[model samples]
Target: MKINDILTLYDKILIGFVIILSLILLLIPFYYFGSPAEGEELILKVQQGDELIKTVAVADSYDEPIVFEVEGPIGIHTIEVNQGRVRVQEAPADDPLKICEKTGWVDREGPIIVCVPNSLSLWLESTNSDIDGMSW
Candidate 1:
């Protein structure tokens, strides 16, 4: 109605927003940074661009190499995992660089290998690690 009334309403909305934002900030640490449960295992996650493709247990002992075929815009790319290690075994010939295949093997957490042309990526993750680092 009046200018003063509109200003008062705006103040109320601003206070409500501040209160909600503060609550979210206070609760974020508990939800986002909580300690991992006991006996947590290591895992390897595969993705095509932003989409998640697969998750494999990195701690498990595999009898043979696990092959993962990831299809993207370029073509199909192959990823292999064995004995707690992961490698980009093969990529489409057209990709040329083959950087993902050249990345060799990654066993520990925190390393990520990506095939840019294929839009494929892989990362090693571990909930239980001696080093306190960020992984996601």
Candidate 2:
């Protein structure tokens, strides 16, 4: 078949649209869309019952996991921090759900590790100093 007959007007327009869309999709990641910057300053905040227990800067390298035992409502609970990530290493026996321990390493900001049985929680947050408000 002749090229003209194979690619009609409508077919050409559709092909052009598809090519443009594919190119835009391919280049979207190259244009910064204001996603939270990776490897930025990440702060780990450990809280218990509305009180800020401890704050630590997440480190890239660690000899071993930093372990913390905090007394909670149920009993002693264990928290582990390693390589800019935090997770509940162990939860109290009273925690029937055991959801806290089940929640794996939390490396990004926004996710919170809460041990309901122990009234303990931890979260990673970005220090606003490096984060510009214009990132929208």
Candidate 3:
């Protein structure tokens, strides 16, 4: 007859399970995708071909974003750093695919962005790898 009278025990259990599952799904991404802890810092190395050209440091938090330009084999590439994430802000208009510019902000290592046409690339390094022969 009424809402409470019509509902059964299984329906309430299913609703509670769904709510808990939804909460977990919402939080897991922040755990896995978040940048390193505050003050840890991120090191960015911008290279042209095999030669290293610029080294930039990104703080976990900053007042203003840092921008720089690198002269690659073809032309200049603009790099920007905000907070702890770095990205290829601009590449030469003639770039083949603009892959680097589309890479967006990267806060973690291992996902290096490269522009083959310009022979320019940038890589982020983690400060956690301080292993020595003894620790290994």
Candidate 4:
């Protein structure tokens, strides 16, 4: 009935070890996947399927939004880049879901906005040569 009667000394030790291991696993991802956006020279990459369309340095973007159109399988996608952020300003009219437009602005790397209907994608890239894909 009581915890002492139900669990032996070995049982308590095993439970403690599991808790410690669980915490280590939980914290490992946070340590490895830290946000590297700070002071990063972010470059916005626009792509349609496997083809790379264009890349622009976020810092070099003007105060006035830089608008460009990319032709995809479906139609045209208007993308806006400004103030170290980029977004799909307008998706093809054929896209009823308008998922790309709804994705809003991406200010940092890691989060990718995709338009599967149009085969279009946008994401930020860190230009630091020192950083590897996975620093072991």
In lDDT terms, which candidate is top? 4
Count of backbone collisions within predicted model 1:
0
lDDT per residue for candidate 3 within 32-70, as digits (tens), equals 545565545568888887899888776633778999898
Candidate No. with top TM-score: 4
Among all windows of ten consecutive residues in candidate 2, which has the lowest summed lDDT? 127-136
- Reference-based lDDT, each prediction: 0.80, 0.78, 0.79, 0.84
Worst 10 residues of 3 by lDDT: 127-136
| Model 4 agreement with the true structure over 6-81: per-residue lDDT tens digits | 9999999999999999999999966755655456688999888799989988887766778899987789999999
Candidate 1 lDDT, 2-109, residue by residue in tens? 767667777989989999999999999666445434586668899887889899886564777788788889888888888878998888988988889899998766
RMSD of 2: 5.6
Q: What order do candidates take by lDDT, descending? A: 4, 1, 3, 2
lDDT for position 36 in model 3: 64
Q: Candidate 1, 39: how far from true, in Å?
A: 5.3
TM-score of each: 0.63, 0.65, 0.66, 0.68
RMSD for all candidates, in order, please: 10.6, 5.6, 6.1, 3.8
Once fitted onto the true fold, the runs of candidate 3 whose alpha carbons sit more than 4 angstroms away are: 1-34, 37-39, 130-136
